[model samples]
Target: MATENNVLLTDTADGVVTLTLNRPDQFNALSEALLAALQDSLAAIAQDDSVRCVVLAANGRAFCAGHDLKQMRANPDQRYYEQLFAQCGRVMQSIVNLPVPVIAKVHGMATAAGCQLVASCDLAIAADTAKFAVSGINVGLFCSTPAVALTRNVSAKKAFEMLMTGQFISADDAAAQGLINHAVPLDQLDAQVDALVQTICAKSPVAVRTGKGMFQRQRVMSLGDAYDYAGQVMAQNMMAEDVAEGIDAFTQKRHPVWKGR
Candidate 1:
């Protein structure tokens, strides 16, 4: 039987795993099932040695509208919301802490927790027609969950303004604010994402994984500590087989063939 916790669609190719939010009718809102599915997908991806990158995308006109308000209204239980947010947080944290890089492919509206999802990813690409907002304040509910990722990705003042105003911003605006890496026409979104994934996949997977981990770990540390940590990581990576192969390829003036070692 199709399970409640299996709402997410996953596809893997060339070391990239794309996870799609599948609740189209609700604009891909985060329901208990969707949230659980996201967590499960991330957990599985983390253990899969073949997967080196993840792309979080959606199938609806809206990337996500945040939590499933109808479900919350029907249940009318604060405990339910609590549990849902907790699970959502775990999923977001998994993206941030994953050794593989994650990219958010934003196609339409991304609001509230949806906007936070983009912020949590290591890189984000959006269609020029897409928009983003922290709209919780509009409904008299502050977006506490989304704030965790949003605040970290952009400056505190910028993040606070978006949340407090509850206003929508264009994809270009999002890119300018550092919320996304690039914004292209809607028709070009897939091609752009594919190009990006291919570029990342062409690199040494082992170095990519190690470097991504180091970037996450050192970002939260003091400058000296970060340098010390990076030095250790670089020293270790220098001895890896991929590094040796890369050096040999450079000496021979040829494209390096990565074994993903």
Candidate 2:
């Protein structure tokens, strides 16, 4: 386990790393320091072979309330705002670019950039009582950055409505709209997330890594291009030693011991 000024906490077990945002008093707002901690931690995790999955969790009643509005108001400089937003963008992209899957364990309200954080993850599981919103509109600042992720996770009309009205949606509504994979009772949140983590950990790490990369890369390609790219990736994956071992183990009617290539 590792901790950063008690602002962020990291724990690894059974090939899963859980990063918990620890600023409960601040509602785990993405302050510059917190963002820096997250960025550094994610970069480190990207290079860690022992980790097969990551869970982004929070330690507060509100998962996150987005950027530190009070800090932004204090600075009020265009340059500062630009840098801050850019930093936040990098953090979101890091989650997307991670070789292993990232799951957001949403247990409370995720507003503005917080909502974007959930959307940016590869998968998300939310507690039934959790809420989500791109709520900067209420403060006269358009949630432009969050909208990038919001639109990708949900329909344009639904994204637009949330952006325009700054209304909060229930966790079940988020799941229905494809923003989250599941919405379970608060007490079951940990078990649901753990199930996913365990399943991913049990797979061949190399295949999961290659598949995750292919999934992200193919998302933006034209249909024909996607197929072409996927075919090449699949061909390459087939050549991996792990695949051979997996197939042999299946044919032999026994559990496979993955080498992870």
RMSD of each: 2.2, 0.9
Q: What residue runs in model 1 are displaced by over 4 Å at the alpha carbon?
A: 1-6
CA lDDT scores, all candidates in order: 0.90, 0.95
lDDT for model 2: 0.95
- Number of the top-ranking candidate, with lDDT as the measure: 2
- Clash counts for the predictions, in order: 0, 0
The worst-scoring run of ten residues by lDDT in candidate 2 lies at: 1-10
Residue 8, model 1: lDDT of 86
lDDT of predicted model 1: 0.90
TM-score of 2: 0.98
Q: Show the lowest summed lDDT stretch of 10 residues, model 1.
A: 1-10
lDDT of 2 by residue, 1-261 (tens): 555568899888777888999999999999999999899999999998888999999997989999999999999899999999999999999999999999999999999999999999999999999999999999999999999999989999999999999999999999999999999999999999999988998899889999899999999999999999999999999999999999999999999899989
TM-scores, in order shown? 0.95, 0.98
